[model samples]
Target: MVPNVRSSLPVTGTKPRTSWPRKALLILGFLFALAAIALVAMAVSQNKPLPKNIKYGIVLDAGSSHTNLYVYEWPAEKENDTGVVHQVEVCKVEGLGISGYSQDTEKAGLSLQHCMKRAQEVVPEQQHRETPVYLGATAGMRLLSLQNRSMADRVLSAVEKTLRSSPFNFQGARVISGQEEGAYGWITINYLLGNFKQAFSAFYFVMNFLNLTTEKSPVPLDKATSAVESFCSRPWHEVKAEFPKIKEKYLSEYCFSGTYILSLLENGYGFTMEKWQNIQFLGKIGSSDAGWTLGYMLNLTNMIPAEKPPTRPLSHASYVGLMVFCSLVLVAVLLLSWLTFHKPKCLQKGLI
Candidate 1:
């Protein structure tokens, strides 16, 4: 009875030792998870969309007195949206309006070459072919069309030819009606003032009276009228001496223009004496002129959408982040399951 030794002795409690292969597998899995997390972070940081792309457009406002080229720009992604398009540059063509070249219709087109070149310089070279260039002749061309329809057509054709030759996508040149001009002018002013997005029901009127009479007179109607008359009564030389900076041509017409504007507002538009205070004579709303050119472009390009576009709940970044988190959780669950189900046989036996 060797010290009454038991045939089967209870094994002492000992810690389970993991095999090198299992340890390596666990370390490799951890490293792989870290690499995956780093890869996701890199993708999120580096693979975002590029900077906002700018789109360009050109509008030629061929008024009764002169022609002006306006270069406009907006974000490319928001094409059919409002309050995005804005004027960048405005180049006035030297000499008279396109309609003035009725005698030598070919000169009408040539007159626009300078402004066209300016537009080319203003807009990026890559966007030339796609950039739409429009020519809108106002009262002058309308008057020309009334006086001589054939001549107006020829004048328009000449300008069209010139525009077509340019790198931009030339839209047709046409003489716009007074009503159309007024409506577009209204749109332009309101658009620049951001009235469309506001909660208001007030009506706005735009009078494309005369560009020469844009000088804002900060006085009552009667006083303004008397002042204009007094200014007109003075001798041309004396007036020129008093205001040397004023162009003689424009200076001479101030009285007539001032009177004409007053009459037009009071009689033509039917505004009362009290309502006169509401009249706002603005050459520009912001950087862009308060005129029909911007409205014309907006209509042609359908930049102002009829209805708001539908939107998703989550932002792009948020959606991506959510997806990456879900992917990581799934990978972790799979790795844990694999480690549990594919444990070494020795380790399983030791546990038992």
Candidate 2:
């Protein structure tokens, strides 16, 4: 006899099964509760302070005792155990500033070029070469006679020849003021301490002009980017006019974030919340801190910043236009010089 078969089926026309939807709702509720708890934990953990990227490398022939080159970088993952944020040391340059030099590097370009070649060898990343490199002389440069420190051509020429055309890809160096220096110092402290999220949170949500409730932030930022965008539009001074209570602390946050974004745009490097998904308050380009220092010196001490004027700036965008115009001008000048030196025959030769 064949094995008997058994089947159990619902009664005809009975109500259809409906347990799947109920189970899904239950799981979702549980997940929502877990997420809420996690958010609270994250907020509370942020209270404790942390550290900063002390990424120093040599910029000049910095002698051992006085050669203290301060390096800053976004901590690397391998350095996490040490609580470091900087992974790469992007830039370094010799001398404090251009105003400290006197030589025209046109004839001596080779020697300057050799020094830069050695410097660039340390870190060969193409991107690092373009990071904003800056220089600012100390009291030493100030002591030089006007003739001794005439750096307009020497500095510019040296950069072009020595550092392989701005080895750190600096648009230019600017002398900043004391206020700026203080601002950077404040940022450096906070960055080292990891006090940004809370500091920012308090400023945007808790301490608005109206003192809005905690249920929502006072500012209309749905996310960090939007908040930053609003801040960028107004000068930090203007923003501080509204809040006299925590003016110093708030101003520090404003400057750090503002300078980072400005550096990102100016250097063709984009900084984003995405880059900062797991990180906090630091940047890739060198000299925000240095800029902060120069800023303080200039703003507070009432000093002047100097520069090397561009020897040849191609106004047109395309290389073809630049080459054609520059070449024609050079040839004409050479011909004129020859004619000036040797009259009739030289003039005829130039015309040909």
Give the candidate number with the greatest lDDT: 1
Q: What are the per-residue Cα lDDT tens digits for candidate 1 across 1-352? A: 4664554777686866658657767776676676577657656665666555677789999977689999998766564454368899999999888888999999999999998999988998988998888899987899899999999999999999999999998877888887888777777777888786421111121122222224364335665566556766878789789879655765676667667766776898786777666555666676888778888876765643233444454577976787687577657756765766687787689769
Q: What is the C-alpha RMSD of each candidate to the true structure, in Å?
A: 7.0, 35.8
The candidate scoring highest on TM-score is 1
What digit string (tens of lDDT, one per residue) describes model 2 on residues 1-352?
6554444544566565568546655555565555455444544444334433222122331111111223233222223233233323323333333332434435333333444454456544554653334433332333333345455435444544544464465333323333443464454445444564321111222222222223222222234444455665777677778667653643556645544543553354443434433322332124333223322222221221122222222233443454455456555545554444456974467545
Clashes per candidate, residues 3 or more apart or on different chains? 0, 24
The TM-score that candidate 1 achieves is: 0.69
- In candidate 2, stretches whose alpha carbon ends up further than 4 angstroms from where it belongs are 1-100, 103-130, 137-161, 164-168, 196-352
